[model samples]
Target: MKSFKHTIRALACAFTIAAVSTTAHAAELRLGSGFGDNHSSTRAMRDVFAAKVEELTAGRHTVSVFANSELGQAPEMVNQAQSGINFGVFVSSAFFNSQVPEIGVTNMPFIFSDRETAFKVFDGPFGEKMKPLFEAKGLVVLGFMELGFRNITNSVRPITQPEDLQGLKIRLQNNPVHIATFNLLGASPTSIDASEMFAALSQGVVDAQENPYAVINSFRLYDAKQKYVTDTGHFFDVIVFAVSKTALDAMTEEDREAVIEAGRLATLEQRSYAAADEATNLETVLSKGVELTRLTPEQREAFRTATAPVLDEVKSRLGAELVDEFLSAVDAAK
Candidate 1:
């Protein structure tokens, strides 16, 4: 895949450059995501999101969807959307932490028990409260999709407790809170961009990594020799669907409405797809002979206790008032 990217690198660059052209259609939106072509999120973007945009706008606008970091890594594509280089982005909230530290509140370890609780929190008022933070950074918050729970996958061994992670070098998303969580748990964590994770794991630069089942299956991390998986369910994460505020501001009201509607419908469908496919994705890894470990109630509690200080640390970094408000909102959602 890396070679393929390099082979057509110049042509893909031209296509992306053309995708953002202002002389074209109403929005001519270029949506970029880190999901691979076979991933459900990619399917949602191409089949549902892009189709809805063109249909709602009567073909006056169009979306060109790029997947697997073909456009750029998560943060780079986000920067592109913010700068109007692209029209929209579908990426993990962890990438947004750099811009809005308050968003880190959502990634607190062992925060939610299941996917349903997260859905209620994000789809309700608490989700609304996080929008302004993104808007302030030049991105329009459209809707949220499930990135779901993160778990550990390694070539080393099955992780049954917090101590099992000791001395294991894990590839974590570029989030400070995540790094802190792993550090306290006794693992050496590195911030490797998801785009390069497989290579890093395959080449033995890192012995282990963590991701949701969708990412694990889509990236085929098992092929890189990461065959042990533990169901930690540490952080229930969300994928932020957003567009450039600058581009939206310039769009005609009708075109803007179509774009927003496309995002809304796509987000709804993506969450539905994520919920159903998660079990199937786990089975996929297991079929390939990857070992699976489900942490027991007592085991999960141990992890929760170890990572508890991370919450206070983040609250201190991003005002206690805002973080506490987010916590209150989560409680309200429950």
Candidate 2:
């Protein structure tokens, strides 16, 4: 009789342990980004996001981040996120061209004059119209993360004018709009993944590349391989955190709200960090012996003029109304 009682007690305890383990497994979430913690805006945002989520979830939910293309490349990760193979991705708009072509409009050169104008369009109608398109493709568009205005860096020579860029083998993101813009400016643009850019530049695979000051510093582009830095403000890049709609739908209401609120907080913090320290970053790079080439107003205008045709092509492909709405928001912001 005592043996029968002991068996019953053991079975009850086993069932209780299984129930607790199952509940714990259901509360975890995964996030993906192509860059690691040191130089990546995505990683900065993710770090803050994870902290916020833990706070909002009251420890009920946990998040894991895969940085530096741990899961896959940026473009492939986006597809994985959408297919519900993972929870979310912090990805640049360049990769979105494959899924939603309209967002490529951001890559059009000189469309934004500065960070304020860029945010005006992104936080307004231009960004809103893009929300549905992501949904149609099975992804959720979170708010924008900062990618400062891109400038050119080269080991070859100073790039003060569009002519200077001519015949230079430049590394460009794999987006049609960006490739077209560089080609129009007379560069021999080659599409290369960001992870390989350092080695590519080191091995003379490419002579020049362009990215923001933050990126230049983060990627350690001031190393001996990169001798010149030019603030052309050719175009800006934006990273948006997206979640798989299928995975999002599987979450409880409380969990979804926690994820979103965390993203918003992290974006605001990261943007402030990027914009507030430009002077320091610039000084650091120059101290490393890199020549800083500030474009003369005339030279900037000349470059803009050369790239104007690319805008027409982008609008036609993305739709005139889309561009109009973006411009309207910019005008309103002013």
Q: lDDT of each model, Cα atoms only? A: 0.88, 0.83
Q: What's the CA RMSD of model 2 in angstroms? A: 2.7
- Across residues 48-69, which tens digit of lDDT does each residue of candidate 2 receive? 8888888898988778888778
- Cα lDDT of model 1 by residue, 150-217, tens digit: 98999988899989989999999999889999999999999998899999999999999989999999
In model 2, the runs with Cα more than 4 Å from the true position are 1-23, 40-43
* Maximum-TM-score candidate: 1
Output the lDDT of residue 134, model 1.
91
TM-score of 2: 0.91
lDDT of 1: 0.88
Count backbone clashes in candidate 1.
Answer: 0
TM-score per model over all chains: 0.92, 0.91
Candidate 1 clash pair list: none
Q: For residue 155, what is the lDDT in candidate 1?
A: 97
